[model samples]
Target: MHTTPHPPTITTVAVPPGSAIASALPGAYFADSYETTDPDPATSALQAWLSTVAQVPGWTNRLMALRNRLVRLAGLKDLGALGGDAAHPLRDAASYRVGDRVGIFRIRHLADDEVVMGQDDRHLDVQVSLTKRQPPEGPPRVALSTVVHVHNTLGRVYMALVVPFHRRIVRTLLARYAAR
Candidate 1:
């Protein structure tokens, strides 16, 4: 049997700032940005990830639906995250768990500290980093994001669910599976 990485779901709750849940790990991971110079391994990795997830049966429909949303969100040339209505499926499937670790990836903002000779700019370059975080005894996290230009006016939209909420997502998915 093929095992896939699943992120946790989000519930109604108040969490502290800078904390995991408050940082929107799951959503951010899906819509994260990487450096332009970085290796383009995600194209293959993402395909493999989706393939592995789809093999689980029953959940193929749900997994594909989320993948489409991710494609649309990334196809946009804008420089921001992807946003959607509350009823959007992506919002609901934002959380999942493969095993014990809750899949809540972190989005880190990387700034360039160099200066351009001909261009007058303060921050030369800025990028975002994506990393997975696992809870005490949950599924392993998958960290990843796309690269976008910050100067774009369209910006980006993402479902930001903090790290603390990761457990909530995992708990929900697990309960649903357990009920079955």
Candidate 2:
């Protein structure tokens, strides 16, 4: 459970303006970014993304299960369990491809510094990106960003109900990854 010498915190930042993700996903009703100091420049975006997801805590998964049950009653998709846990850890997870499933999301794009993945449903289309950057004079940093385009009133209501909890859950997840 060792942490980095740098601040063990993740900062909520603005999503890169006019980024490609934004260009492709215009009219997004919701978008946000979270950043953390990433010391290792060798880490691939897919690795960072998978490792971060693997950090999802048990309570969060439980909450998701409850959410799944409730949402299913509304005819929403049952997303199943969240991610790999200690009991079922993700060791040497590979097969990173464009169409592969990464938890509830699919691999949409993979690059050296960023991997973009998310779910597209009748209600909304979500695109999530995990990017790593190496500034000139400081330790490297990693960022996770999400952009959502809602398709209808159902999407808006669903987003409204989820956005608040979404922020808290994402902060908790990113903080856990930052601690690593």
Candidate 3:
């Protein structure tokens, strides 16, 4: 397990210029990116983050379980069964491609340094991108960014309700990766 002397910092930054996500949609209602130093490839970092997030425990688990149930009750799709043929633990690069579903999002694009996932519903469209950047004098950095465009009043309301928990979860996930 990964450990850190202190919690890793998660800063809000603009989406990097020229990111595929920047051009994926217009007028995003919410967009934020958080980056931390990590030598892992973007895919691996993302997979690790997902593993941590999906296996929620204790109070957080109960909260998420309730949230998932509510989302299902509203007819939003759950992550559907990941078939036996599907990559276990969802870390395989080859398993992701346009139209592939990973949890509630669809893989929109994938590359050596980045992967883009998105979901569109009657109320909103959401896109998430993960990227790894190697610098000349420092450890490689991994960033996760999310952009959302709300389509209606319901979309706005949903975002309002989710943004708080969203911020905490994203920060916690990145912090976990930094510790590793």
**Model 3 — which ten-residue stretch has the worst lDDT?**
80-89
> Judged by lDDT relative to the true structure, which candidate is superior, 2 or 3?
2
Better of 1 and 3 by lDDT: 3
Q: What TM value does model 2 have?
A: 0.86
Task: Score every model by TM-score.
Answer: 0.21, 0.86, 0.79
On the 0 to 100 scale, the lDDT of residue 104 in model 1 is 19
Clashes, model 3: 0
Candidate 1 runs further than 4 Å off:
1-11, 16-18, 21-57, 60-66, 69-174, 177-180
Per-residue C-alpha lDDT of model 2 across residues 83-156, encoded as one tens digit per residue: 74333344454666788777777778878787888888788888888788876887888887889999899999
User: lDDT tens digits, residues 68-154, model 1?
Assistant: 565466563222112212332122222322221111122232212111111111211222222233436644333322322322322
Query: Candidate 3's C-alpha lDDT?
Result: 0.68
> What is the C-alpha RMSD, rounded to one decimal, of candidate 1?
15.4
Ranking by TM-score: 2, 3, 1
RMSD vs true structure, all candidates: 15.4, 3.6, 4.2
User: How many angstroms is residue 59 displaced in model 1 relative to the true structure, after the best TM-score fit?
Assistant: 3.6
